[model samples]
Target: MDRLIDAIERTQNPSVVGLDPTEALVPAQVVASFADEVRDSVDTPEEAPAAQLAVAFYEFNRTIIDAVAGIVPAVKPQIAMYEALGPAGIDVYTMTCEYAAEQGLYVLADVKRGDIGSTAAAYAHMLTGVNAGASAEAGSAGAGAHDPWHVDAVTVNPYLGTDGITPFVDAAKTADKDLFVLVRTSNPSSSELQMLDLADGSKVYEHVADLVERWGADTIGEHGYSRVGAVVGATHPQEGRALRERMPRTFFLVPGYGAQGGTAADVRGMFDANGSGAIVNSSRGIIGAWRTSGRYRKDMSADDALALVFDTAREAATAMRDDLRAVL
Candidate 1:
């Protein structure tokens, strides 16, 4: 978490672009090349599509990563997007995570894994590069122990309470990683459960926030923020402000910043007086910039069109950075 904060402070940008690629959303040029490659391979035609599409997905992610690596402090890859393409897609996800790390960006895996303590421990190990059965001696190993697929942080689901979250907290401590527990999500239906009032007069998410604060207490970084952060949607600024007050030491992974009706002004409440403690995310808004902006014209050659796509992505990332900086 401290390392992540350092990167954020150095860049003076708290934005994290999401690398979520779908087959249908991939650029036609890239997909055509990948399909050609699949045709040349010896694998079955049916099996080849997934593998080839995975290549296209990786290409898209790599391009986006290259475009925004220097502008944003981090990139969050939603695992489900990669999972949808099957085993081959997972391979692309791994490649993207490693590539982002190599480009000097914090990679946050949005796994949202929740289960019993033991299963949660496995999830923690899988994301943080810790072996489930490693000895305490092996566990003490430094950052070098992390797996290539490991990320700097991961999002977890807290519905099961401490039983599901503690393993992640412990693993984060051991691996020097971070966890963003889902407190108030960005989806429209999140309120159906997260806003329920308890008999004690506290809301469900508030209690979860309290526990999240406690989980990262001992692991608070020099910036006075805990390794255990909260996922508070930018769409609900009032709830975000209240949660900021309640969890003063917890960093925030704010979603819904764009393409979800969450503007820069709406997310101001998630940050602190110093413009720290939160990293706003924009997924499709950034990745799909070329399609929406008309910068990549059909009249251009395929090579030139692809170049324009990268340029559009870079411009979009820059715009997002400027927007957040303005509000912060």
Candidate 2:
């Protein structure tokens, strides 16, 4: 956790580039490149199209990783997008993660998996190699013994409370991995449940935040960020600030910074005194920037499209840091 925090501080940017590859948003050239291979392999035209889409998606992610690997502290790969494609999809996901790690970029598996006991352990092993298992060994070998998955951390859901989180906690400690527990999400509908008043007058999310802080105490890292971190959405600046105060030592994995109503000002509250402690993630806004109406167009050449996207994302993150610097 300290290493990651140090990396972010050194870069002076908390931006976390999200690898959220969607089939429709991929560059036409990428799709064209795979069309012939897909068409030759599959029987039906429909299957051919699907195969082409998958290939394009993977290539798009690889390009994005290559573009921003050194500019950002981390890359978050949303697992749901990959899982929706099946085994071949998972293969791409694994490869992309390994590739990101090879570039010395921290990979956070944004798999909001939540279950009790052994099932949770399985998820932890899959994401961070926190457990001792054959899959872990295979992963370690595949990433190269020295590479070892290259994942520094993972994001988790805490709806099941301590039981769901304990396995992840144990595994992260054993493997030097880190866990970011979802507390207050950035979604518009999150308040329906998270903001509900408890019997003791505190909101439900408040209790969850307290638990997250306590759980993180045992895993505090040298840079003051904890191996056990919390996910507080950037959409709610006031709430984010309150949560930051409550969990001073916990690293924050903040989503919703782009394509989800969060702006540079909205996320400013996440930083600590030293302008550390938080990583702002932007998914569709970064990876799918080319599809955002007039902002960027799908018809642009892949190189030009990607260059524009990288510049935009880099500028957005730089602006946020600059704003924080002004305030501090």
Candidates in order, TM-scores: namely 0.93, 0.87
lDDT of 2 by residue, 67-119 (tens): 67667778898878877877557777778888888888888888888887667
- Model 1, backbone clash pairs (residues 3+ apart or across chains), number: 0
Candidate 1: lDDT of 325? 91
Candidate 1, superposed: residue stretches over 4 Å from native: 40-42, 130-146, 298-302
Error of 1 at 117 (Å): 0.7
What TM value does model 1 have? Answer: 0.93
User: How far in Å is the alpha carbon of 108 misplaced in model 1?
Assistant: 0.5
